[model samples]
Target chain A: MIDEHLLDDLALQNGLLEVDAKLKLAVGIGAILIGVFSPSPVAPLVIAASMAVCTIVFAGIPARVYAALLAIPVTFVSMSIIVILFMTGGGEPLWDVHVLGYTFTLTTDSANLAVLLLSRTLGGMCSLFFIALTTPMVDIFSVMNRLRLPDEFVDLSMLIYRNIFVLIGESIAIHNAQVMRNGYSTFRRSIDAFAMLAGMLFVRAWEKGEEMLVAMDARCYDGKFQMIEEERRISATGIATATGYLCACAGLAVLFRSFRIF
Target chain B: MHIMEGFLPSPWWQIWFIVAIPFLVLGLYQLKKLFAEKRETIPLLAVAGAFVFVLSSLKLPSVNGSCSHPTGTGLSAILFGPFITSILALIVLLYQAIFLAHGGLTTLGANVFSMGISGPIVAYALYVAGKKASLNTFVNVFIAATVADLFTYVVTAGQLALAFPAPAAQGGLLGSFSAFLVIFALTQVPLAIIEGVIIALVFKYIIDVRPDILVKLNVLTQNTVNRIREAAS
Candidate 1:
């Protein structure tokens, strides 16, 4: 079902922010309710399917790229489940495999458990991804501010986001510097190199902090952060959509629970 | 831990949302303090940028083919303090949530609580504790790094417990905690050590070469001898 049509939809847009914010508020509440009240099997798949559909329709990204991006965590979750399922010591053992002083037994429940976990994780990630990809950063912060979060929290979040890239660049430089000088191609050498990299990164960060403090004091700063714009209010339509989506998700979860389908 | 959708009972997540709202509001209000006197924090911003960027590249080894990265809020906490650091952490989490999918939008509150708030507070607390006792700078940073990592993992464990409850009451909590602890122990210890060493070395070099800058940031005092004694003692 993963197709190429969705691939072209990944482009960023002005409306994407509204769509994403609305979806997130809706999905976040909905998912939690479902997690608590809904039954298994059907509930998990339905949730996953709905998210998949959203990713395809609203994410504005190619389906393949979406899949690829999702694969990183999904793969980890799936593998963990697989290892857990087969290695677990319950249910009818299909076979026993001994490796590295450990015995792994495969069972039906384990397989079922694995599938269930993977499906839930993938579905959840994809849905959340859809919202993030669609929404612009500033607007999301605005929405949080509107939602009644403190101004400091919002501003700090902005600062953190701004600095992340800079920090990553410094980390890479330290890493590269280690590689060039230490030649950490071997396991032990790599560990030493890694230690050195960590050491260098911290030293650089502290120095940068010192320089930053001087700059701030020179400008007469005293621990206050201010943003340039006014906060945006949530529209009625946005509120309505969020409410309706949440209600539907809750209703569906309740319905599934009543049916007792696990 | 990023709680996937439909994992925790809805009520729990809602409660977290509620708890987070006020803290967030208070944080916003305090933000003015970070720049109250119309001071330029561009230098701090630059440092923040560099710190986060470098942290991103240092991956922790975990389950096969998987790795977890330190939130790195500990160092941020020490330099920027918690209130500002929390918000900054939120921003970092937000970007990662969108571009890298390392976190999710819905779980932003939880992530903020863990990496943003708790991590830095623990780190800062350790720094204060060390300072009170007159421990060497390296010892202080190392202990802070270690404790911060442990506390962050504990917070992560609490979050995961919300997401997936243990099937049985007696053994479930222990099982879940152990599962996560095992994974964290495999990865976080080395990361903390590295981070601690990094902070100490950097702080030392800064003191030696750029005493004025440190004093400006309030990291070091205008009296150089006192600062050295502070570090040494």
Candidate 2:
């Protein structure tokens, strides 16, 4: 599994540091909307390709990291698309088979639907990757706050975000201790070890919550947490460039659809 | 079991988001009420949220040689009610989407509905039923966790089937749902069983060490606790 904490930290230090966080967010969301609404695969394919280039070239994210980030979703999407491919029948069969009194066939319509779904999914993923790889969670949360989400909801999210790392650290420590004692040498032992770890973690979590509350009380914490907001000004040049690029992509997709250029 | 980013088309994703909003609103209301009543609930819910995140992310070894991760929502549903679990599920799902890319922003609604709402509702119902029927604590926890996990996947399969029905099947939605359910069941069944056992043992340990906490959480009544202690002894 990828260490997302490390990835987010790395993203904070990457080349897209100068761009406005909101602009990056807008670009990501815009790409997804376009990918979803476009009539043909042309728009999605183009969006995905361009986003990949921007991430690898402009954002300076490592190609390997980008590929690794995509690998899991790609595998999942492929599995489901394969099911889609096999399940749709009754048209011109590219391949056909009979099993247990049922005809299993891959048809033109199924192939088309599979391709569309794959392109749309990939396009959307690329857009999300651009945002996730370029921006950090704090900025995203700040954006949510700026969007006027309820104070309570944003505050709770912030608290959970901060504590996730703490709990993960504690879990790792407990897991390591158990492993050193050969707690997972056998299947039964593994189950026992896991259960103990879970039980301990639960107890520890409750204690930690109490400790945090006491500490907060000591510091005169009221019900709501105060967050410091950083000023981020959007640039006209960046917005213009993003708009032009999106429009050009849309125009190309329209042309492709009209000309039937697969 | 997350529905990956952009997996559902426009209308389907929108419909799910609309369906999920009411549950989320109710959860927020419940959370506010809990916080007002007990100030400690703030930290408890925060830590519970983190617990769900960490626990769900752990890759456990399954009997089928494929790795499986427990949802961890069943335990939370038993401790907190289903409504609060929905709020935690939203946070966990959002975190996974933004940081881990496991699920998507657009598809968050579908994932939350399956993993957060439907699964926890079923788990909480099973738990309440078990308590009413005076079932053994271990058996009750096991059934709730296992069935909750299975139900999450079942709902996920149903969502997928609804989005893309099988062309070959004459039964339309039902047929497509069965196909997806069967595919998921091959792996999800054994994984659910393993998760159930793990959660049961963990609950048993918690009961043994600190029955007070469970009682404090209102998860176990005094009579039930006495029965459990007697059964253990």
Candidate 3:
């Protein structure tokens, strides 16, 4: 169960783990914005490539893992891109098709829009991965606190963060037990077993919650949860490098604004 | 099944955020009030939110060998309320975006609005309708959870259609809506049914194991629990 997804483990072991979380967040968000705003696909495609390279090459994330993560959206996105390509109209018609008595036409504008959409999504997802791979949720908690989010919200977020693992661990144990019992030997049985698992999961989590409340109260549970103070000072070089990257992307976007494949 | 990060363009993303903020504020406010009255709810809420995360992670065993995860919003909305479920969904979506990059931060508003806000409301409404109609507990939970699961994707499809209204696509918005709907909503129908079944089974287990918790949470009254137990025994 855990093998399917365990991103925090990656963040903990990343090469850029020690870099400032805020800096990483800024770069990720900046690149995402630049990618989104660019009318052309060129800038977003560049951002996507650069961000993927940074995550895999700079941050030491395994190439296989990166590709696997990226593969998650390929099916849905390709479908979406195709839909946009065939459904949108205007500009020059590049191709025409007659299917089921409907005349479907692909046009220049649609092709350009499809490519742009595909690249923007690619860039956005990669930039998000860059942040996810580089920054641990603990650091993000501190960042959230710094951003003036309510203490209660931050505290609850921390609690939720901690419990996700606990619950996942619990789930894995249950899933294993179910597997051992021949719970999933057939498709129909598997559905029943999985339903039982999902049902019992919340019940188990509720019990865990009560146990945790007792644990916290025993430890003098206060309304406040402490934030990890930011240790890495924001360096001039980090800022300059991030700024340079954002500027380059913005400039590329402007330069290629009118460039189109169709 | 989230609209992966960076899918929605600028103005649409910002518009969703704006639409979602007031609801979030109301949710956060409701949570504060709930916490003030019952201190235990704080942990309960956290765990419930985590429950959503865990639920989403649990893959359904599909016949075709494709993966589909349950939305858990229907169950949560029934146990808690829509207000709290919305924020829980927001938290869960945020975690997915930041850690797993399953959804985009830019599109979190849209995702939350669909999965968190709209799905739960539909579930809650169906639940109330079921309760009023004196429907069987299993059937009630089944329909509510199922339709809610399906409804979330409809909202998502609508959002996409509104955002990307192709001018030349025959019937324009209506035509493109159906096209997008085929991709976003049609595929989800089977998964949604599976989710409903799983959630209905979950409710059965909850009723058998912790009927008091259900009563306390206001999902079912003590009287209804007694009647159900009487009928069961």
Q: DockQ numbers for every candidate? A: 0.25, 0.60, 0.73
TM-score of each: 0.70, 0.94, 0.97
Clashing pairs in 2: none
Q: What is the interface RMSD of each candidate, in Å?
A: 7.5, 2.0, 1.4
lDDT, candidate 1, A1-262, per-residue tens: 0111211124345234445454564565465445445544556566667766665665545567766776656533543454345433335656677868865556555555555555556556665665555655655666676687654445556555545545556766666776677546665565455555555655565566566667657777544454454435567776786677666666766665544212
Candidate 2 differs from the real structure by a C-alpha RMSD in angstroms, to one decimal, of 2.1
Model 1 misplaced stretches (Cα beyond 4 Å): A1-37, A57-60, A74-119, A141-251, A258-262, B1-6, B18-26, B42-50, B60-66, B159-172, B201-211, B220-233
- Give the alpha carbon lDDT tens digit for every residue of A47-115 in model 3: 999999999999999999998998877867876777788888899999999989988899999888888
TM-scores of chain A across the candidates, in order, are 0.69, 0.90, 0.96
Model 3: how far residue B68 lies from native, Å: 1.0
- Return the lDDT, model 1, position A233: 58
Q: In model 2 chain B, which range of ten residues has the least summed lDDT? A: B167-176
lDDT of 1: 0.58
Candidate 1, after superposition: displacement of residue B39 in Å?
A: 3.4
Q: Which ten residues in a row have the lowest lDDT in candidate 2 chain A?
A: A1-10
For model 2, the stretches where C-alpha displacement exceeds 4 angstroms are: A1-6, A257-262, B226-233
Give the B-chain TM-score of model 2: 0.95
Writing each residue's lDDT as its tens digit, candidate 2 over B1-233 gives 78888789879999999999999999999888877788777887898898888888776756876556788999999999899999999999888887777889889999999999999999999999998898888899999999999999999988999998875454667777887787777778988988899999989888878788899988998777888888889
Q: In candidate 3, which residue pairs get closer than 3 Å at backbone N, Cα or C atoms, i.e. clash?
A: B5-B104
Q: What are the per-residue Cα lDDT tens digits for candidate 2 across A1-262?
A: 2144445766788799768889999889888887877667788889999999999999899898888888758646766787778775555778887879987778877777787788888899999888888888888888888899876678788888888888888888999998899988998999888888888888888888889989888988677887787887888999999999878777866776632222
